[model samples]
Target: MVTAISGFEPTSLSLVAELIGTAVFAASGASAAVGKRLDLFGVVVIGTLCALGGGAVRDILIDAKPLVLTDWRYPLVAVLASLVVFRFHPALSRMRPTMLVLDAAGLALFTVVGTLKGLDYGFAVYAACIVGVLSGIGGGILRDVLVQEIPAVLREDFYAMAAVIGAIIVSVGARWESQIGHWTLMLIAIATIFVVRMVAIRYRWQAPKPNI
Candidate 1:
């Protein structure tokens, strides 16, 4: 079970999750830029896009101002990550799995955040869950499309589904928040998403597709 925290006190764990998600998503985007033979500026731009694009889309959909435009910290985190990757790309190349793991964590966190945000804005639980999935994958889709590649969520394993499940947990768990603490429920949901994604990556699991 999972739930959203109301009156959102910025918990240390939640802050860390946000930072990790921003940094690793930035790293992933930077890596994509490298794959496309992009220059340093391109890497930074792509990284920033991946870090903040999802949240931006989520905000827009919910009729909120884009956080990236209002929050310096969001882009700051992304810039720092982009700089690190730009300077250490050669070494970072060997850390692909670490990046993916971090991305999984980010996905989980964003799913929770997105769903909660939607609920806060008066969306129904299921709609908020859908928003959560969008918030988890929107940035990656933007990054990949910019790089001229298919969005990984559309082509691969449990990437999108993992986030969807996490969002669903958050949506449903709100009903049981009194029985299970909201924070605890949120943690459980995040863990479920991260584990599901990691397992899919480790086992090379892919969603079944049409043979045609």
Candidate 2:
């Protein structure tokens, strides 16, 4: 466990987290497609965008080849998740609470992963925080845009705020603790985001909306 964390190597835990995140994001995308009454292919397209678009954008900004293109496993996981949601959306629709939990988990993981990737590409801490927030929110933003809706982060609860806090913790924590285990860092980041988001959801918390 320490070795996996120390070297920032892929571990079973991280793999599972990544898979869960991919599935949740794909479900969100597929559900949006279903709401729009789009075809199967369209559902897949949206799912791909939701599950992989943020990472792709991050990689592009970092001047690296997108991981989704290089990683067959990533796209495979995405399409399979999209298909399952497409076929079983009726049953799945009843699982809104479960979906929210999964969404929170994904949001947490994405923020950490994005921040790490940004730092890896030589970004400053503040820039990496911004990248992390963008990566956490980008996929959903794209989905909302395609569906002709306002993005949730802009108008909704503390969605982006949670990402900001988690990412900031990650950047600062790593810098403060040179020996901090990567897995430990990742876990801290995930827990921070999930706790903030869940609490916000439970309390109906909202950022102040300015009257135009």
Candidate 3:
């Protein structure tokens, strides 16, 4: 019921973003499973876990209903995404760059959605930023753990850092919500996060390692 001046409904927007992010992440998970030569059931499991894990963690932290549990559409979308990937994995596997793009898009969408949800739940900016980062990376961590791979957040790649920056952008921009519409801020945060992540990928950015 929270409607903004631009006729933007925060809850509705969040729902849409969450579903899209879920699908994107699900596809990524399915694709990964396919690459690893997992069976169909394993592909579905990984996809579902990647799609819902982050939102579930965020909801639990905020004491809100987990969308993956309460909303049927979420799991359905995830499953459908997984099935589609499984069916056409040959083409998908060939498009590694495309998958990377989708992953970045998923991260951006989830980060913004998480940060906004935190604000909706009355969290302060900094705390909400942390929640946002958690929301962005939780699913990927679960996916990686299941596949016996190191979580992207803990890797030398710039994945978690990109999410952290995106979360901060959303949280800080939210402070000026009146001056700039929340929807506008949401779009800005998503774009910023996506760009940062893509740029990092292109540049082969690496987290600093020990000099030992």
Residue 22, candidate 1: alpha-carbon lDDT: 92
Maximum-lDDT candidate: 1
Candidate 3 clash pair list: none
Task: Estimate the TM-score for candidate 3.
Answer: 0.91
For model 1, state the Cα shift of residue 41 in Å: 1.8
Across 37-142, the per-residue lDDT of candidate 3 in tens digits comes to 8999999999998988888899999999998888799999999999999999888778889888988989999888888888889989898888888888998889
Per-residue lDDT for 1-212 in model 1, tens only? 13344776766767777988999999999888988889989999999999999999999999999989987888999989998998999999998777788888899999888888887788889999988898989999999999998898899777998998899998888777788887878789899999999999889888899999
Per-candidate TM vs. native?
Answer: 0.93, 0.93, 0.91
Poorest lDDT segment (10 consecutive residues) of candidate 2: 1-10
Q: Which stretches of candidate 1 lie over 4 Å from their true place?
A: 1-10
Give the per-residue lDDT digits (tens) of candidate 2, residues 46-94: 9889998888878888787888988788889999999998999999999
Q: Local error of candidate 3 at 87, Å?
A: 1.9
lDDT for predicted candidate 1 compared with the true structure: 0.88
Model 2 regions lying over 4 Å from their true place:
1-10
Error of 2 at 49 (Å): 0.4
